[model samples]
Target: MTTNAELAARFEEFADLLEADDVEYKPRAYRRAAENILAHPSPIADQLEAGNEEAVENIDGVGDAISSKIVEYVETGEIEELEELREDLPVDMAALTRVEGVGPKTVGSLYRELEIQDLDDLEAAAEAGEIQAVKGFGPKTEQNILENVEFARTIGQRQLLGEARPLADDVLEYLESVDAITETEVAGSIRRWRETIGDVDALAAADSGADAIEAFLEWESIDDEIESGPEKASVRVGDVRVDLRVVVPEEFGSALQYFTGSKDHNVRLRNYAIERDMKLNEYGAFDVSDVDDPDAGQRVGERVAGETEAEMYEALGLPWIPPELREDRGEIDAAAAGELPDLITQGDIRGDLHTHTEWSDGNNTIEEMVEAAAERGYDYYAIADHAEGPGVVGGMGLSDTEILEQVEAIREVDAAADIEVLAGIEANIDADGEIGLGDEVIDALDVIVASPHSALDQDSAAAADRLVRAIENPAVDVIGHPSGRLLNEREGLAIDASALGAAAAEHDTALEVNSNLRRLDLWGSAVQAALEEGAIIAINTDAHQPATLEYVRWGVHTARRGWAEPADVINAWDLEELRNFLH
Candidate 1:
């Protein structure tokens, strides 16, 4: 069966092939269709199979042409046009594009000039000094490609949390619907809410393991069954691998603790148990100092805790730790000292400061965005559209005149809205650390999110200085996506976090944790450092659409991982408190 992920991949490949062939508008259309397809809540195959082509076409950015292709692929398991395009280019698009500086155009150029068909072919040509012979290819570009290709090869693939979590939720809901499964939960790095997951681990408490395993295998979402046993099963849901383990209800707690681990955390817990003459395992926690064979049975000697995860932790003489704090980064000690922080929660956030509208590249209009924020019960929302400057693509940025016009539009929206809508601009910070917007324009706005959009290759000292200067700007409320890094794609700016954090704290400027999955900037460790240095954090979704407002949870969890309290985040404050900080 074709899943949304599979269809999205094919569409992306189609886009890459079209771009390689120098096809103009269609490539962008294909790419947008791919993104919308991935973000679609339900499986695309189901819609196609139901013969609802109109519903499929209704997907944002998907036109009749793309919808027809999706239906064809669903019915025939292939798209003939994509096949023909592949036959024409015939190079490994995914592998070649993984190289840092190489893009589809470069791939097309290399294929035509040197007949390079794969990474190996490209590497051999580079090694032989033949790549520089191509018209636009220089020796430095070839050398950089050779160096980056190896790193790309070594880095294994991991699904982003944004993608993996939905699949995990589906699995959990499926298991809960079964009569045999009493309790079910997802484990592994997903439970820890890591940015990426290798494979999903699910656990179930059942009266009979065989019954639970059978129900799991029968789940409709399973595309392929990899393996199955009396107590466990592994299946492929779309492109993701899910492993299910069933244990007797009595042992659910110990089993959950064992599976939901950071390896380091479990190791520390085991050592701590040993000091108390107890044994810890997946079956249950046991007092084994007097037992002849501690491993004699699943529940050896006297069982202390196994029914619930809280019980399992209580047996270890510690309070129940939040899953996000299970990283073994002083969390154990903090729990022991009864000093665990009251971490920030989703409900604590009162507003979103950095958002976009159709005035920039966002899909929704200013009124639509404001209405969405009001619906979400936010006290205030800021319309921080792109200001004319670096990294603004396709003339998406607003000029000074346009910014003034937008301000009036924002005011009109705010007048009818239940929530406060602040007129703001996402100004670009130039390489010299000056904001692209004029001082008058900056001061005219209720908020300013100054971000480093270009010159990301600066050295550590320069990057730190650049950010410090932005923080020092009296009108700037937040330094957005401090490094501008995109997960698994770009290693954006390299700044001295301690220096940046101190400067931000001193200047009363908040550092932003842009919650877009691709750019979860001011990630856990950076958030921790900044918070420790008295810097205020703002967990903004950097949401471009209403659907993306849900991404704020990702930032909240990431902040918890960094030990940020509600008070540490500016968005968590009340309207008056937020206003005080902004001023």
Candidate 2:
């Protein structure tokens, strides 16, 4: 089946190919269609299969031309125009675009000028000092290409949580429908809410393993069966691989604990069990010291605990740890001492501080965004549209005059709404640590989310200093996506987070944990460091559409991984308390 993700990738590549050829307008249209298709709730293949061509065409930003291509790909597994474009520009667009400063145009230029085809060819040209000889290219550009090509080469193949979670849910639902399956869960990194997942691991408790495996193999979404047996099966669903394992009811707890792991965490647990003259494995926890052949069989010992995950932990004399805290980053010690912080939950959040509207590259209007927040039961919502400056292109950022004009527009929306609307701007933080907007414009807003949009390759000291200066600004309320990193793509700024956190605490500024799966900046470790320094966290979705507001859960879980409490997050406060903080 042609999945929505696969279709989106094809359209994105098509856009790149067009851009490389210097074709204007159509490339942007294709990219917009691709973004909406990727974010669409239902699979495009399903709609096409159901003969809903009109529905596919009606998708936001998709038109007759793009929808026809989608239908063609769905029916024939190929798009004629895309194939023609590929033939014309037979270069690896994805690989070339991975470099920091390289774009589709750059790839086209390099290929035309030096016949560079892939990363290796590009590297050879850079090493041979030939890229600088191309028109519009210089020595610095060649050096940058050389430095980033290696990082791009090592980029791991992993699926984002936003994409993986839905497929996991589908598999879990299908397995649960089997009469023989008693309990089922998604384990591995998916259970831990890792930003990127290598594969999906689903576990089941069943009386007859054969029955469970049969049900799994018959799933509607399974594209290819990799392997199968009575107890286990592996299948490819779309582009993701899923492994299914079934165990008896007695061993479900142990299996879950073992499989839902960071390798380091499991190793520590196993060593801890050894010191107490016990053994721990996927089968169960057992008293090994009393058995002559503890390893003789899978369950060959005096079993201590295996019925529940809490029992497994109790056998080790520790509290039941949350899966998010299973990263072996002092979580064991914290659990043993009963000092683990009370983590924030979905119900704790009362408002959103970062969002966009049609005024600045967002699809929805300001009124639509405000109403969406009200529907979510939020007490307040801030409209932090992009402010014009560096890295702001395609007329996607607001001028100072335009931003001031939005104040009244926001007020008009707030007048008939249940929630308070806070007019704000996402100001760009220049390399010199100055905000793009003037102080008067900054002072006029209800909230200011200062962010670094350019100069993302600074060294550690420079990055830390740049962020600290932003934190020290009295007009700034939150430092949005502090590191500017994109998971599995660009390695944004490398900063000393501890130093930056202390400065944020000193200046009463909050650091944002950007909730977009692609950019979960101020990630787990950074959030932890900031919390330790008494800095506040604001988990914002950075939402551009109504559906994206649900992403706050991702940020909340990421925060829980860092030991954040409801009190530590500003958005979790009540309206009065939030107002006090803002004031």
Candidate 3:
């Protein structure tokens, strides 16, 4: 069966192969079609199979050529042209492109010059100084490819939360129609909101576990059924593995708590429970104080609580802990002392402070982005387009004169906008931590977000001091994506989070938990350490388009992982409070 994910992946591959073969406009069309297909709510295969050709044609970017390719793939299970392109290049496009700077053209060049087919081949060529000899290639590109090879090799071992969570939600929705199912939820790392997930795990509560498992296998999104048993099943959805476990309605809570663990967290909690003469496991929480051996069996004593997750914790006189805080990082102690923070929620964000407009590589115009934010009921919004400097790519960043002109443009729009619109600039923090903004430009802005775009390979101490210098710059209001890391793409920078956080707190500057899925900088542990010094955090989407303003959801959960409360996040504040902080 063709799942949306599988079809999108094929087109993505088609685009890469076409690009490698140097096909021009067609590649972008295929890629855009693939993205739309992945995001399209209905299945193209089902539409094609049902003879609804118009539905497929109506999809954005799916013109005559792309639509026919979809039909051919659906009807015959293959596209003849894609196979030919694959044969011509015959390289692992996905794996090869995972290296930071290696694109289709680079892949085409390397394959033509050095016949590099995979990471192994690329690494061999780079190590032997072969890549630098190729035209338009040099030592820097070769070394970067070599350095990124291992990370690229291990890229698909885990799925991004942004990708997997939606699939899990689909699973829950599918299982809801099962008559026997009493409850359902995502489990494991996905539930904990880890940045990457190994498998999409889900749980269902039902009187008949076998019936629930049967229903799960029939899910329309499933690409293939891997295994199914009486109480559990595993299946492949797109490229990721999804596992479903069905338990008795009575034991649902206990199962959820046991499965939604970080191993260390469960171990610590189990030990804590043992001290209270209680035994905990998937079966249920048990009062084994009078039992001869709590270790004798999985369920050795009278079950005290198992009907609900809260009861499972209540059995031990503790409040139910949020899954994001269950990483064995003092959460257990905090819970016991009633000190667990009221973690920030997605609803708390009032506006986005780090958005872009077409003025700086954004897809939408300034008016469009601000209107979209207004539609989401944001109390305020800010336009912090990139400022021209060393790392600004292709001269995309704005010049000082342009920024000032844009500032005037924003003010004119702000007068008519439903929400308060702040004029801002995302100035590049150079290697020496200096921003390129002129004093007049800074004076005109409502907020200034400083970010590092180059020299990301600085040593830890240098990285820390560089960021500290930015934090101490009175003109700067927020530091964005402090580490500059792109998950699975590159290990961007290694900064001393504690030192940066302290400097930020001292200077009253905010550190950002950039909401872009690839750059959730100031991740949980770092945020927790920084907040210990009373540094404020701002969860900005760094959105480049109107649609991506919703990326703030990823940012909110990321802040929660750091045990952030409503008070810790700046944009979560109302208009006045946010303005006060920005000033």
Candidate 4:
């Protein structure tokens, strides 16, 4: 039983292997096919298994060859060509690529030059100063490899939310068809929307727990059954492990509340309940204010609440806290005081202020990208492609003349386009905290997103000052990917969020929580800090293609974790108000 995710992973591995082998054009093709397969509404392998090869091939990026491979893998459990590729390279592709500056080509080069097959081999060579001696390699490259080896070594302990979440959605969709289950919801850190998750946790309410577990175990996507009981089971799905728990319909609310915890929040909540002579547990809330004997059992008191999550919270005289805010970060007190901010939702974002096009390094044309935004029902869209500066390598950033030209093209599109269009530029902030854009270019653009592409290794103090300087510039409207961090990939930079947020507020500059899965910069705590300082947040995807516009979901969740409200997000405003704020 092949799952969409498992099939997608196979192609991703194929893409990497081909890239490592320096096969031209085919790598990108395979990667695109993989992305499409992963995003497909149903399982391609299932279609293939059912003798629907045409249906599998009809997928956007899947072609004859790729579909044939899908058919081969589905029928026989292996793609012979891929196994051969593995034998040829014989390197740990995933682990090696985890190192900061290393990619498939570099892995190929290292493997060919120094026989480095894995992180251990790479580490040993770097430590022994063997990498520096290889042709086309230098001491700096060797040192960088050494520095990132340990981080690379710890590659697969957690799964990316972007990857794990879709699989969770698939699981939920499958369980919805179970007749025995009355209610179903995800639990644990996944429900809280952590950037990285240890495993996927799902909860179900059912009259018969045995029936629910039986249905779960029969899931076609499950690769291995780790364990199972009458009401609970754990299974492996691709690289992620999923744990499912089923409880009686009556106890579902309490069980969900207890499981969807940050431990600290639950402890704090339990203490608060104890102070009121109430006992809280997964069973239900109990009023134990009066008991003649102290030796009574756990359920010895009157059950006051637990039928639903809201009721559970009401029993303790508190509002229902959003899962993202259940980190025990003053949310309990905020709920009690009736002062919890209404967090921003995905629908609140009206436009994308920071995005890319073919004018720079983006994959799509301006017209294609604009059409995608219009389809998403956005009121406005800004084409803020790159402006030439440091760290924007291989002539990826546009020149001043080209930017002005793109501005006119954008205006032309705006004339007949369904949405308001703004000509913008993502200008680079150099090490000295200066924007390299000329006055003419700045005046011509409708918006400016100044970002630090270089000097991402700056310490906290330097990073804070550098960003603050950029924020204070009157021409700058936003600071993009403030910390420059790439989750599970690169450390990027260290900045003082308090200092950054304060300066951004004073100067009316918005700080970006880049929606790209890898870099959710200005993450939860940092976004919270910035919000506390009265700074605006822009959850931009920084999308290079139309499909990536969906990254806004990740940004929205990250913002909610930080307690961001619609009022605190500039793009969440109407066009008129957004213009006022930009101005």
Candidate 5:
């Protein structure tokens, strides 16, 4: 199968080539194709094998040449043209282009003239006084490259959503404090609530665009300034790239709607506008048919202005699309059919079904966790600390005997506090599908969450069987982090989710959308499949610490991606219904 990453990398390489050649339209076309391909829901190889070239061409901005490139790359391991281009250029193209202000043309020039192949080689040449001797290379250019190389290596990968959210909030607050900035919105994947974020993008409507850009560049929190132009400024803040674009108030909503995109969603929306003899872009929408000239028409190119996101959607004859559901899944269809789901809100969740306390590995005690839940207006919560045996070690989890004692202890805290705290245990599902805690202890707890903590290397078929059996256990109320994947660091167990979801539904068990940003497993597809099989989803934060309870937002957003409505989630029920299901 052709991984999306591979296709994206190729598109970027193509973009690099087009830029080096100084071809305007080709570069934008490739970049747009890359964006659409990355946002596609299914694997490109599956579409190709099914003989659906339309799937490739259906993407917005993919032209014939770009589609052919994708087909050739999938059939072979490499793109022939990219390979030829690489051979023509002596530089380590990827590495050279990473330097700030150095694009592919600069790389090509440096490689042909100075013979720089890698970051280290470039640095050595710059130090040896060879790069400055070249015609187009100046002392400033060489100096910048030498300084940025080490920073690039130490900058680390992009920030995960868990790390970026607070930073984005802080940025928005800072921007709002500035008098010149009138409106602000965080755009890009962070806005889309993607699991991982490469950058934090903010678009602002300002009274004075130039002043706003200058103010953003001078912000104290910015760790490093990457680029600052008249309308935009890019900075690096604690391993996350933050880009801010300043626009006029008149163009604010239109720009926000365009920039806050799952590119695929915007493409579809744009195509919808085109079908209706209208046009949409970052500036605004325009009525094409109203213009006299189809080719040389100015009104067709003119902005169909909007001052709010609702106006943008309204012009398109639909309701506003939430940023979280901007990914091109079925959102368009839902919007067209007027069947958009009433997404589960934070307030809709009446209880926190899975949490930890000092009884296991959690930082807070039972009373503290319950009080925090109460502070958040939750009517009920479950203290699901770890249970002993199998994956449990270092006395981090309670023994079977200790679990019964803790249940009584939980009741005491629940009675004292104003909130109801159900006794629960996060029991381990061993290799053989058996939970670590005995049935007697499990039966005593108000909620039993069975999770896989070991043997993650099992074959896919075996992994699927293990999960199915665990969910089938009458005492198991929830399956925790179905795939157990850790973003960027690890790929967890793979299971046939459809089979597992069916089993869970048959057994009256609920599947959890583990809200730990690091592990958003039961991903969107799994959630959708689970819902299709009539399985209820529990959006649990699986909070080990007080601050982590906020992660439920990401989980709920993830559920929206899976097409889960308020009714599809078990935790969205009242306290009594949730308790009944646990029993």
Candidate 6:
């Protein structure tokens, strides 16, 4: 009943939990198996149902033990081996490890030494002076655990992109302002434009390591210092930890490429490099002519490093892949064939399709929003604030009458404004997957992006049905943030994306790759699935404010990761074609 990807994800979660418990090589084995399972096209369950359990052995990196476990899981809907492992060290292991300074080994040690089973137990132990009594843990370590426990409880798991982006920018600006810093760029999930962030990673290419490290520690924006070292430094800015790594200029680009990764993407790229007879590392890639020779490529006769990203890619016979397209979702082949998607660039966006003014929770007025769009060289802008419905409460949504009044106001603004103004509404997708706006109201709008804001708890089957029904609505021009996810904060609706994509194609509805960094809802995997289903994506910035309009960069990045080319994006079409699609 489960898909290969789901099986892999479950196994990966178990592996992460096991890793946090310091369970040793078995954790690595599980993680490796998870990786192989994710890429396997055939459903392991289906294969098992068809009585081909040995098919698991065909998966690379899945050895006998893992294959047996998969057979057990597929047969009985459970893995006895995993259950036994959980029983041995049964605790809130995942939660315990989620703290800032806590990892698997630390969690294991604390459990063994202090008998701390959960967050509350660990907190009690930390307060009762039991933790500092452990050999490796000292006064500082105890303080860190206690401080982080409070933070962990207050902040939950990950920070939203809206909160994390500004912090990364602030840190980068501060680092750049310092005299010791030569150059700096944000790397990690933030740079990759992942919808959520666990930590903000920054890599600085500096001449003096000591000076850069010192400058980083003294940054006023840093609320608390976590760790400071020669190559790397970590500090807690509010709830988020900002990590900075200093690299020599020679390997800066390579380091940037390595550090800016979705771990799976990096693994595939690494394998690709190895297959090409090269080796990639934090330092620039090496020829690795002789694997037995540790210093073979760095020897006197060989070139040791790539000074730029292009050279690094060239070493592997790959054209330089963009950071956003580094998800390995098909970009490798696209890059190899020189058919990389010409994704929508920021300059190509002539106007914002959906935005709010003071009429909603927006920070600016409609006129101000338009002026900002004009500043970005936009020829037209649409004011598409929320319409009253299931998700909109506390005066956040406009009533039907108010929506009509706003349309007239938009017409008035259009007459006086230099750029054309269109009236639009972010209509609500009701409980039964129908837009609340009637045909008359829908006809009055230039465009309507119907979105599911509530009832996100619908099961996968029901969610798919709901979305399919909504996509069939003739008034729906775009399905906003198709999944409704807010990164790590919210899982959003569970729908069969491939099915949804096919339905959208049939209905001629554009799926919005919402530019909000927190809600890059159509994830890279979903985007790839959608494109394969021939679904058109509109890379729109559901801009609530002018400053936030720049989030299109994040949307573009997400689309590129999905291997989407300009042709795949409805917004990438010319204005005439776009208008025709809207109508």
Each model's lDDT: 0.86, 0.88, 0.87, 0.87, 0.79, 0.76
Ranking by TM-score: 2, 1, 4, 3, 5, 6
For residues 233-285, could you state the per-residue lDDT of candidate 1 as single tens digits?
A: 99998789999999999999889999999799999888888788788889888
- Candidate 3, 310-383: lDDT as tens digits: 89889999999999999999998999999999999988889999999889867578899999899999999999
Estimate the TM-score for candidate 4. 0.93
Q: Judge candidate 4 at residue 521 and give its lDDT.
A: 82
Backbone clash total, candidate 6? 1
lDDT of 4 at 180: 85
C-alpha lDDT (0 to 100) for residue 297 of candidate 5: 44
Tens-digit lDDT track for model 5 on 91-181?
5666566565567788767777767777888889888888888998888877867876774554336566755776688689889988889
User: If both were scored by lDDT, which would come out higher, candidate 3 or candidate 5?
Assistant: 3
For all candidates, the clash counts are 0, 0, 0, 0, 1, 1
Between candidates 1 and 2, the TM-score winner? 2
Error of 5 at 304 (Å): 3.3
| Candidate 4 RMSD computed on C-alpha atoms after optimal superposition onto the true structure | 2.5
The estimated TM-scores of all candidates read: 0.94, 0.96, 0.92, 0.93, 0.71, 0.69
What's the true lDDT of residue 486 in model 4?
72
User: For model 2, what is the C-alpha lDDT against the true structure?
Assistant: 0.88
